[model samples]
Target: MTARYDEIGVGYALGRRTDPRWLEPVVSALGAAASVLDVGSGTGSYEPPARDVVAVEPSAEMIRQRSPEAAPVVRAVAEALPFASGTFDAALAVLTVHHWPDWRAGLTELRRVASRQVVLAYDTALHNDFWFVREYVPEVAALEDSRPSAPEIADFLGASSVRPLPVPWDFTDGVFPAYWRRPEAYLDPAVRRSCSALAQTAPEAVSRGIDRLRADLESGRWQREHAELLELPEWDAGFRLIVA
Candidate 1:
């Protein structure tokens, strides 16, 4: 199935750019690899400067947005990679596995192609932790909770070892949990458009949620309860890098 990346994922590169704080750990998990495979490398967000990276993504729009400096972009799905067996020293699938039709098959493909390591970065659950999910949009949280779990993914990989890395970032990337601390940003249409949940949900539901959020912000109801979050520099919203 073709994802509407062109329509919804258009401003993603500009708004959802990689957080530098997360890069060092993600790249380090790849080990001392010379050649790397960046699976679902949308807009080349986290492609490291050191390695000889090769990117693979299914979305044509996402592939088209790849930087000139990034590795050559290939239009391919994770369930079935186009490269030869053991083609890469390490592989990275960052925040993209949930979109795959067959996550198990995709993990198998990642294992089959990589000689050294396979790093998977994604959030475990968005519903339980953040106030946005617990308060304004529980439906979106329900949608996200259906995604595969970290343990399930690790089992599929037959990982000899699994390490959990923390998710720490400063600014919101227009993604769901990105604005947990900055509730005011969610009121912006541009910010709301960047969220897949808001984009995929029924227009009426999204509009209702937006309207409620707007009312809460205007009445200072959001601040009255979650005013403490403003003091924090970053939050650990159940995001992790699963290194195998």
Candidate 2:
């Protein structure tokens, strides 16, 4: 996974900043835990600031991008966390499980290392409905199809609670679906550089899709079609939180 992230996740930190709104649920999921093990901690985006955290990620490039204020990060993959049993009060893997080559093993390690675990996941529902995939890049649907379902991830982690997390219309983070209300952002190569979906996709496909998207926006077709979405403060873009 680090190999892939290193290749496609270049300049990841520049655009993928933490959105404070996302912290509400992530921090809530931590509950009373004072210490956390952040597995697959890409750029330390959602790691709680108030808690003692030890981050583990596979990509050194991502580790290099972490803010000086971030937790001490270990260069390692989630498949094998270098911690003793019940080492931390909680663990977090946000928007990252899908990248693990051995997801079940990674979840097992997460459970072994912490009493509580939280995972943010994506699934097929939003893969088809998010206007981007439906309108521009249908190949992304194939990628989404290959990813583990939220329920599957929950079952693996022994999570009894799973809930939807909405994407704010003007979310600061540059995660794929976060730009649902701002379609023009996807056309910017620098913006796309931060999105694994666009970054890892075939350049020809991405260029063609962006061109069509540009055309639609120039003709006012995009706004005419998605006028109601403009009025929405938030929309469910298939992001799910699972707590165990």
How does each model score on lDDT?
0.75, 0.87
RMSD of each: 2.0, 1.3
lDDT of 2 by residue, 1-244 (tens): 4367877778899899889888888899889999999998988999997899999988877887888989999889888898999999999999999888888998999999999998988765675678898889877777777778787898877787888889999899998887999999997888999888778678888888899999999999999999999999999887888999
**Top-lDDT candidate index:** 2
As a whole number from 0 to 100, the lDDT of residue 179 in candidate 2 is 90
Query: Which residue runs of candidate 1 sit more than 4 Å off their true CA positions?
Result: 126-128, 160-169
Q: Model 2 off-target regions past 4 Å?
A: none
lDDT of 1 by residue, 5-26 (tens): 7678877776777777777777
- Candidate 2 local lDDT, residue 128: 64
lDDT of 1 at 128: 48
